[model samples]
Target: MSKERSSRILHGFISACLVAAVAAFIILAIPDHLGRAGIGAGSATKKNFPSAKNLSSIVDLEKEKQAAEVKIENPSGQLAYFKPEQVPIPPGQDAQAQDLTLTDPNQSPDVAGGSGAAVDDSSFGNAVPIEPEPTETFQGVPDNFVPVAEDTPRGSSITLVTYPRSSLAIHEPPAHVLRRSKKEYSWIFTPPELEKDVAFWKAIYSRYDKNQVVLHHPIYLDIIYDVVDLGYIEGDMRLSELEKQHKKEKLIEEKRERIVSILEMLAQNQRLSSSLNDEEWRIKKLFDNVGDPKKFQRAAEEFGVRAQIGQRDKFIAGLKYSGRYLGEIERIYEESGMPRELSRLIFVESMFNLKAKSSVGASGIWQFMPQTGKLYLRMNKIVDERNDPIAATHASIKLLRHNYNELGTWPLAINAYNAGRGRLKQAVQTLGTKDIAKIVKNFKHRAYGFASRNFFPEYLAALEVAENPEKYFGPISYDDPLRFEMVRTAYHISLPSVAGVSGIPLEELLELNPGFSSKVISGDQLIPIAYPIKVPEGKGSIFIAAAARAPKSQRGSIRHVVAPNETVNSIAWMYGIDPTRIRQANANIRRNPSKGEIIVIPFD
Candidate 1:
């Protein structure tokens, strides 16, 4: 057979098989199509299938392809052939709900909000809803503040009270109140005013940096009062002495002038003709220009002027105490709404010395004046709470709060603390601005000394020195903080009595209780009733119990025998007692008690 004819016969046989397969596939697809259309039970028709006429109709293959592409792009719209019974339920979430019987909706109880599956509550109970735990909100503390403990008494919420800068004058604290309130009130300094203050006081603080002056003495500039140096003169000579010195210097000058005139006359007459060498002429000129020794003899002594910086090693040693209180002081400052940076002011105020005192009568680590101390602290005959580190810190923070509220800026408020808010207000008012630069330049008062102008700058310097002590100062170490626990007494008691009860030495007890006045230590006064006394840490309960059992006779009493010079005030001063109390105690006796009269000193 020819190869072409055999190939033609094979192609015809293959065409017949393809036709038979296409017919079989169409016949099988009809049942599936009918079942999907919900017509499976009794429906079967050749008309339902694609007919020859439908296949002959013109169809755009490209359009069909585009439709397919659209369907593929929107997969969510694609039909899913899933049976309701086939879905897998989460295990344990209705474990017994295996049978999903379909029934009339009206016949079942509404299960929308109900427990589950319309089950009988008597057999399968409802799941109890869990109540969410409550959340507590803390105010005034920084987000990053890590409270030491959950139960510590320290973390009560503090609300921040803000005052507008313009309203400062309206809230101006009285001059006397500002003066004696808190010494650090005067010690407070903010950043903006600090720039100008640094410029003004940099020369003084630089003395410490330069090693020429290890001590920096800053006097308040009294910018707030428009009084330079607060009417304080470190040293001033009597007018008479100054006049006498002037006369003596004048006489010496006349004598020198007369000699010079005579010499000139001699030279003009050629009578003073000489062949004097350069050395001889220089000596002669020196004698002519020399002032009288007696006239200048008392110059240095006149004002008692002397460099304040001394004992560089000792100053650094004093700062060692600062390390012990740093953590505690900074914490209090933060809690009190004070900028923690100002805690370094303690280095300037007392060098962290809890027993520190100023010549002008500021006392304690915070250097509060007695008058100011009395306002915030117990500064009576028995107790001077200003000396207590913890008590003084709280007072100082309150003072800072006042300053910030009134002055509206930490810098201005801090200056108000040191220089007096009334004075600062005046400076702000007179300058018509709160700008530190303008106030520094335009504000002038005899009372405003270098200290007031440079307080914040000095504080900044101290902060700088403290922050990097190793860089500025040499190697340094600090004492361990004097850890203590406080206990309150129900009745008046002597510190010595407390010392006796605690089995601690009297000196150590006194050291721990710096708040107690000297009279209390001397047994002339008693610890204030219901006052808190500090004991070594973990010993408050022991001390309280022991103190309660202390002898009543040794607790406290005052008795004085009138001396030759013992007036009520004089007697009061001797024992650190109030004169009124002395007078009241001796009401039957004359105001001027006779010598040898015995008087009872009352404690109220």
Candidate 2:
């Protein structure tokens, strides 16, 4: 009896549950929302307007269901029409009107809809006022179930993504080499053309350690695009203090190199003055500390062929410079009452360098001081005979003449060439009080600056070496000879014209006339000219006659205008005059030519 009572109670409970479920189903079958997606809104569907012809009695249990139920055997069709909330969206199929609500937007187009069958919208007809079914609640896990700990990687930490699609992200533990520096690096790419490289990058990259290097593009290429994109993701790279300092040092180094390279090129081109230092060019040390000819000779040798060997043509031609001129220095010196060997001083003072100048305004082979030059030689602002090789040599010869007369000794005459007569007199006077050898021995105690200190030695060395270079040093060949003479040109005659008339090249003319920076010079300046070894030996008159062959346009209307401190004979020699003719031109030619004396000459 107790068991029957218990069974009855169970039946009553089941019946009560059945009744409640029926009522809930009826409520769910009613139209719930006003719009389309399956939420708070109701939407239109086939259930809302099913065919009236197929209307069946509500008493037919299966027919009393909501829309989407299909006919089949057993129970008339299907699994519980997936509740709109549980609809799997059929992957590609969209929601129908009854399966969804319309009021809400942002609905997934694939969500299926749901509704009841054949309901009419009316207040009094057969329309039923349907209330929305409450959404089914999600049941959570049972409290009685035991939970297990989740597995995780050893070093992994989790981060929940806060984006729309929340996901689990991991924050990896630090790497093996933890970077202590805050410094960041950036690379700048250069366009291939803009970069002037000697393939340095290619060479560096070729040997670069593959494991150590990051950028490894083979062959030369521009990676400008890649560098640009990095800027967007990381802004600018931040440098640490150490990195900034390193960059500063690198910049300084590059600037220093550029300055050095520029200066080096300038010096190499000889455009920059290095008059004081020669080692900068990698020349010999002997040439660097230069004051005498030995060092200059080394420089000449280093310059090699272009200076000496290549100059052979001109040096050989030096012997051919004849024009009724006194090219015989030896004979001339013998006549000047001086040692014939004194002529060799020309080679030392210059390399027979027709044009040589000193700092204190000495010029020509025998360098002279300006004040001293003024006392013995003639010089003017408008004229510096000091620059004329022949005239200066003549003056030198005269100076030596006076010294030879006084000293009565050859060495003293040569010494007097360097040490002036007045200074020699002072030296002799001082020598009376002291030993001459002792006085002149240590050159460091010499007067008259650098010139006096080395002057006598240069002359002596030049003389001894010229006579017996084979004995003292080694065999040496004297340069061919001084091969040039002066020829007069019509006033304002261009060098180009003289080159045209004389059949001598323009360059040859300029070389022979190094003193003429321009075509113009002193009023009676003799235009330098060169002739072959053979010219009529005694045709001074004929040569003067031939010089007159220049066109009238090239000649000055007036003949010769002599200036102050110039003798008629001096002017005549300047015009390549005959000494007899000069004496005939003016019995007093030794005196200055009067202000205006128009002397006639043969002119074509």
Candidate 3:
């Protein structure tokens, strides 16, 4: 063969071998590729069957997505759901998306995309932004934001939100806000005429302490003669309480006499004198508003220096104590259609002193005398409702309501609470005006004294002080409001038995049921049937159960039939009980029990 032909053959043969090797390589690579594909398929199946931990995480994510759903009530009253993230939050509130609810009942299901579905659209309409309101204090929704509504799309539902009236901010208009309409408390308007009197009392409550005595005119409370410091008398540990009081009175009397003498001298002079001392000049300056010279004599005789004990400390303490019942008191007043502010009168009457009693028999925080108390409260040997803060509060509301109905003005009515309604009516008729300022300034009667004249002013002062206690007393940790559950007694039960069964402390029971007399507390008298008793909060059911399980011997009063020779003392001696208790138990019991007559023996 030729050399070229041999080379061509070798090349052809090598090419053939190379082609065979390429074919073999292709055939071997196909299986490896198939094995890799099978491994990838196995990996895909493993992914489909996730680990338990991963499955749990997926479930949690789904739950979070569901929680973020906002429920919107449609016009048909069916609930529609949409993700909260779909709605834009108001600018300043930093409100949580979940907290936002599309509350507009007129909303259509399509607004939420569909019932129980997420929203699809990013843009609904131009959202009307709500202007934030300024608030002093509130607890519910942020006062800043009102409900925002979007303009409805022609073919689509608009996102609308409407807040309930109670959820709306109670915005107190700024001083610049136009006072065009009367408010609910329009009747409680402070007359410009009595502003000075109100200011004077406000000062007494917030500015001065008990050891200070303010000497001012009876009519014009703004008039300042002097403020005598009785701190020395009070702080004298060497003196007894009676001696300190006597010394303080003597000092006050001396100061009044000196003031009266100065007034008399000023009246006699009838003109300003350069020879007047610094003290005299100061006194003269307070009367600059009084143009007449003869008025000085009237000031001496009619408007003599009246000393007022400062009550700043007492007022602060009262503000703290008032928290205990102020909520309930306000609720009662509001329910009875009376201004809640009227409850602040207790600050003036007794400084929220539950056991306060006057020399003339006025009692309780309301200062209700026995005569007036009897009209609304139960006052007897067994129970004196006057001592109960809640009962007295109710009684006071009734009395105040009656006074308002009769007197026709809140000021006059409130004054009538201190002074008699008859006297206030007489003043209104005599003065021929319903204006409290006119009555307070001009009315003159034997019964209408300085306290009666200033009662309304004091009330206004107390109301202002109480409402803004932080402004006057700074940050105070007020006592928590009284929390209790009321349960009525099924039987005539003794307090010990109730305490024993209910598992409540005896002292707590006594404190809660203050209407119970000493006799009742001591087991000499029994709480009447169906009498409501206050127990600790969440203990009403427990108390009821305990009361039901009370033994018969511990439940009610014991009774005895009078024999032929059974005298009251003899019967009492036989039962080992007090005759007074027997008399108290039986209202119509005579000195000697008649034969065959039943007598209720007071027992625990």
Top candidate, metric lDDT: 3
**TM per candidate:** 0.45, 0.35, 0.61
RMSD of 3: 24.6
Q: Write the per-residue lDDT of candidate 1 for residues 1-604, one digit (tens) a residue.
A: 5999999999999999999999988878777688776666655422343221111122232443233211111121211111122222222334334222111111111111112221111111111112211222111222222212122121111111111111111232422244444454444334454554453333333323222321111221111111112011213344465665455445444544443443344334443326555533432343233254421222222311123332234346556765555555555565455656666667667766777888898998888876666446554455566787666777777777787788877777766767888888888988888876566556888666555765666666665555545554656666665455444443345566656544556776777777777777887555533344555544443344434444431223345556553455544433334566667767776756776777765533
Q: TM-score of model 3 relative to the true fold?
A: 0.61
| lDDT tens digits by residue: candidate 3, 1-604 | 6999999999999999999999998877665666555553434232242322111122232343354435667553334443333333322223442143344322212111112211111111111112212221112222122111111111111122221211001222311123434564665557899999999999999988999999989878889788999998899999999999999999999999999999998888855689899988888788889777678899998768888989999988887776677666665566566766687789999998887999998888888887777566555435666788777887788788889888877887899998989999999899899888899889999899888999998888887776666778787666666655444433455677646644567788777677777766876555543345666654444454444434321333556666654566545433334567788888988876677777676544
- Using lDDT as the measure, what is the rank order of every candidate, best first? 3, 1, 2
Q: Which has the better lDDT: candidate 1, or candidate 2?
A: 1
**How far off is residue 454 in model 1, in Å?**
1.7
lDDT values of the candidates?
A: 0.47, 0.35, 0.64
Off by over 4 Å in 3: 1-183, 270-272, 489-491, 496-506, 537-553, 556-604
lDDT against true structure, model 3: 0.64
Candidate 1 CA-lDDT value: 0.47
Tens-digit per-residue lDDT, 25-77, candidate 2: 76675544322233444344222432211111111223212331222222211
